[model samples]
Target: MNRTYLTNIDTSISDVDFTQHKNAVFILHDQLNLDTWPSWIREEKPLLIFIESAAKGKTLPYHKKKLVYLLSSMRHFAIECAEAGFPVYYHSTKQHYDRALKDILSQYEDLHFTFMTPSEWDSRERLRTVISEFSTKVEEIPNNFFLADAEEYKERVKDGWLMEYFYREMRRKTGYLMDGEQPEGGEWNYDEQNREKLPKDHSVPSIAETETDEITREVIEMVEKWYSGHFGESEDFTYAVTRRQALYRLNEFIDERLDEFGPYEDAMAQGKYDLFHSQLSVYLNNGLILPKEACDKAEEAYKNGNARLNSVEGFIRQIIGWREYIRVYYEAMMPEVREANHFDFTNKIPEMYWSGETKMNCMSECLKPVIEQGYSHHIPRLMVLSNFSNLTETDPRELNRWFHLAYVDAYEWVVLPNVLGMSTFADGGVLASKPYVSSGNYINKMSDYCKHCDYKISKKTGEDACPFNYLYWNFIDKQRETFSKNGRANFMVNMFDKKSNEDKKAIFESSADFLEEISRYKKEQ
Candidate 1:
């Protein structure tokens, strides 16, 4: 199993004269866009180097489907580069990246390596270590995969660190959904018009499945053989591996799902995993589709009257506003952000998260898609999955790793800010204003999950009560001082204060017992 899968096919040159072709471009798994190639690379057609480290793929017990998606995509891109008349040296190896690069360096003389700055912090550090050793041969450029300007973010964020301010600044800068100096439709955000629950009569568009070609089939077989006990199933692996397929999915989303995407963007339901949400994050996070291109297509849909402004604006906000802002936020808050634990919750993760077996209907429903397909829309992620974690005081770091391991779209840059900052409030109000914990009533209002649950949503205390009800109050009472400073969350603190002494005691006891139960469940597992 430690055997490496390495291949090198130089289409342009058969000879191995490293001094003749001194310039080379190295492609990472995430930076797969051909159009983003530098002018020198396009003109000179320098040697293309791709390293597929199996050791890197198994760094976190990554979902088997994620493994297939990433490795397949890399292989497909390598073929594309070969067809495009570039000499490719593709390395599929179980060896560490540094050692692999060292071997490559040993074989070549006066060969220089240029790569796009890696998206993840650890990847950057590893590259830095290699660059330090080969100072004359290796260099990197700023990653253009994202559209946010760090300088603009710093200038706009002087007033506050909120996303809205940064989002508006990006709107003005990009002129996306903008009319002259003001926002299109006289509004900056259409989120208020969104957030409607899924109606019974409403139908969801079917998610487009990518057909497995020979390369993907080979990858699935390799991943199954290599990663047997990883997270999610790889049997039904069907994700767009090439740029053409990713664009097709984007167009399909715009044509069928974009119009209704605004209203039901946050809605979740039983048996409906996608619900009007454009599952383009997988494409966006990887380099299959650029942010500007996707945003432009959505804007065109709005202009042509094919999609509503609310839907288009909402989709654009996710790209330019939240996604880009989070990238910048991650850059600003790393090393420290990784270890940020404000409430310092030391509890271990529950068994139910991995097994997807739980009496809680909402948690089970949300965790199902993640375990089966390595996907779930944003609402389920923020409300149900991370909500349960925060309520149970699970370590935010463990939950972050689970998100990275469980979701195909998860990268450290996106997952860390979201899990530690937004979801769990582990950064002490740096990424999110407050903890995103909520009772079962919110879940009931959003979806029909509570109506069929074992624990009564109406009950606020006792053994049969929904655990979220007591856990929310317990979190509020424990973090009263933090909530009191937060103007928006202060009302929840007042409500918890108004609870009678007996009710307070019942809430504390229920939360305590439930926490113990999950902890014991973890121990048993």
Candidate 2:
């Protein structure tokens, strides 16, 4: 006899079941955890579900390897779910979610279903509409992959969503950065300690390991075959394909590099991807590893004397501070959020973003890493590439698409908050108090990009001048009236006042020429 029951369920419960059908489907996103499937499996013994290339809304200009990486990762997760004794039903969807759901419902009439909430705002909205259309009830499961629930966290921090306050609350609640209710370190942040530039003679340690097993090898081969037309180099894809490999990478960072992570976290060096930087974001974002496990490992390293408090705090802040904050912020504002254009930017993105063939050394170096390896450190992302995009008046949506396509770890939920909000200030002031616009001087201060560039770093107007110098002031000058009223923009306005009208006009003309040249290349691409 078929039976169904609905019990008391809160949003925190990671699992739910509809007991009538013997067969059920668990729709899994690429970033969702497999453990959330057990409750549905135990009750209905239903088949599992997965969708390949689940990206909807727009077709992105992604590197071929990135496309393959996401699809292959989804396939691998499906295989593992099958091995765990769940009958799996997986399909690649080129249709929109509504069409895909209609197709699936048409095929399986007697199936009960449960789905972990999708990370992306659009996906969740689509699922809501689709499920409402079905006569049969569907259970929505909580996503336990995150350290805290999004809805709950939103309610908790509704009054003020500042990251510092939220981060402090998380540390207090979890005892992550605490010692008997006091912070382990006297200070909550170690920002002052984490700004050392790499010494010219400094040597970066060789990466811990690069060993891919049979599954990863097969995934890589499939990516190369299917996505050869995309922009990135296929030969440089060497990320951990499984949870085991991801753990190894994390442990290696905690053991060998975490102690120095804080002091050099923002430093960029030539031919170095891991100078006191954790390369585990690819794994964490892909669901191969959890943020809590990473945080715990870093904390353990501090206790074991393998790392320092500053490093542990800094690492934890990325997961708890930036990562969690971004996820919450994305959920709070989306759909409409994506359409925001505080700068009203209309300029096209440069072709060099796709080709990695820019004359600007910082842009070239940063884009080369992304094109070749599908990754770049955070500083290069915020300060170098995104900074330039903001200064050049590149459309935030276009820039957002480029970022989402370029990185292996890129997903709409994570990348949008970072790109549109923090990087570009496209959300006005919701994500960032001010745009992270900077000149070649800031780049020179942060990295050795100036030493290698063809232009004079200090010059603002001539042919041999740095592009960033002119672009930076031009951005400020163009947007001066908008920014003049913003409290956070007061410093930049004051800096603007220091320049004479002729000097500003000269910068504006130089910037116009530079942007025109970039626009020509964009059309060619």
Candidate 3:
């Protein structure tokens, strides 16, 4: 049966009377709400339009699965809307956004079209421009998924855009760690406690496996067919696609692993894909799960004696602290924000990012999981892969695009703020206070990768030295002038100034060689 042809027979209003009243079109992805629809429908009885934009298809990389995931999810959402007493017009176009809108408007001459604001900057801007031509009113509704409403967050953080301050405020307001208005753990953050590396013999519980449904299986087939020439492996494409499944996964993480999540949240393991980390990001990003619900569940677990306050607070901070903060920062500084580049670094992304053949054990292992499973925990993403990209002076846009393409949870609204802003510091200091660059020592301390790596983690020069060691110094030397003015980077500048010119040159030359070899290996694959 062709699911696309399924219709709501009871609400089958005819095309003949479509132009009779003022119609408003609400554009929605699967991640958006239907409750947002009826209010608009009551106001105008508008023909709800869901478009799979050709622009998105063109802009995304060939190998990126985001297009397929988004389209299929939207299609599923559209089918649900049709069944729920709503008149929906679904359009899949290859070209001309105007053509689609014009065609729809021709059918309903007096249609006063309006759509909720898109989370992505590009989509929002494009729709805003196109909708300006219509004589009717176009109102953009506020997105309510976040705990910190945009206007409220902006007003609350008037002193500065610092995340720490904002996070503390949220903690106080929500009573996340409060014991009757006082902090429960005495300290506001357990960041010191959370940085412990996993013991060598530490055992991680097996990740739960999910079987793909027929719809998901079809989506996987479509991705394989269209994206065969793209980078990354095509196997084992399992992700939660609905709210119920996402909730189940969340519960399992809280009940089974939340107790240990705090102490080893930043630790990485060679063969482990999830080590005390919640892999619910893809679901949260796509609207399958809400942040509030995830946070509330963590709090509930803590209260029920299933988890510790440290673990629950740590988990809540990711959503309420970093995630919400990044979104607010993105909205506040976008359009101009995407163009920020403090170091003015413009090196091309090396091919090793696609093929996991690098000598850097952290990068190799992290990329392997990313290519195979379309996922990696936060620490690997922030500290390993992203750190390498920044240290090697890869073009922030290229690195940002690669991250957006490769990750299962990559959406522009989420990925752009994280990759360009937080991870890479490509947006200067607007998102992150400082660049997250680190030497091989950081990797060695965090994981067991250093033990098996051929390169010496302690060495800064010569053939046996880790590439990250040379790259770290080279990155600092290259960006000294840019970082000197930054108060947070003063210590790094002093360290760079201590190195002799000859030693600096040697590190620079070695980094160049490492980057070249990595690039060649990627092209060969």
All candidates: CA RMSD (Å): 2.4, 6.6, 4.0
Candidate order, lDDT descending: 1, 2, 3
How far out, in Å, is residue 429 in model 3? 2.1
Per-residue CA lDDT of model 1 for 71-160, tens digit only, reads: 888888888877888877776677667778877777786788888888899898988888888888888888889898665564443234
Cα lDDT over the full model 2: 0.74
Residue 278 CA displacement from its true place in model 1, Å:
1.1
Q: How far is candidate 1 from the true structure (C-alpha RMSD, Å)?
A: 2.4
* TM-score of each prediction: 0.95, 0.89, 0.88
- Candidates sorted by TM-score, descending order? 1, 2, 3
The candidate that wins on TM-score is: 1
Between candidates 2 and 3, the one scoring higher on TM-score is 2
For 1-525, candidate 3 gives per-residue lDDT tens digits of 122322321134323345554655656553444543446465544566776555555565534445445555665555555656556766656554545775666666667676666777776776666666554545666665666766767544333478888888888877776887667778777788898899988888765766666655665665566556666665565565555567788888988899899999898877886899988777677676788788888988988988877788899999888888877776766777666676777777777787787776778889987787778899889988889888877788877878877887776767787888788887766667788999888888889898888888878888889888898888877777657867888689898788899987888789888766657223321
Candidate 1 structure, TM-score to reference: 0.95
Query: Model 2, range 267-309, lDDT digits (tens) per residue?
Result: 9876676588887888788788888889999998899888888
Residue ranges of candidate 2 with Cα displaced over 4 Å: 1-21, 36-46, 53-58, 92-101, 155-160, 208-226, 520-525
Model 3 TM-score?
0.88
lDDT assessment of candidate 1? 0.85
Worst 10 residues of 3 by lDDT: 1-10
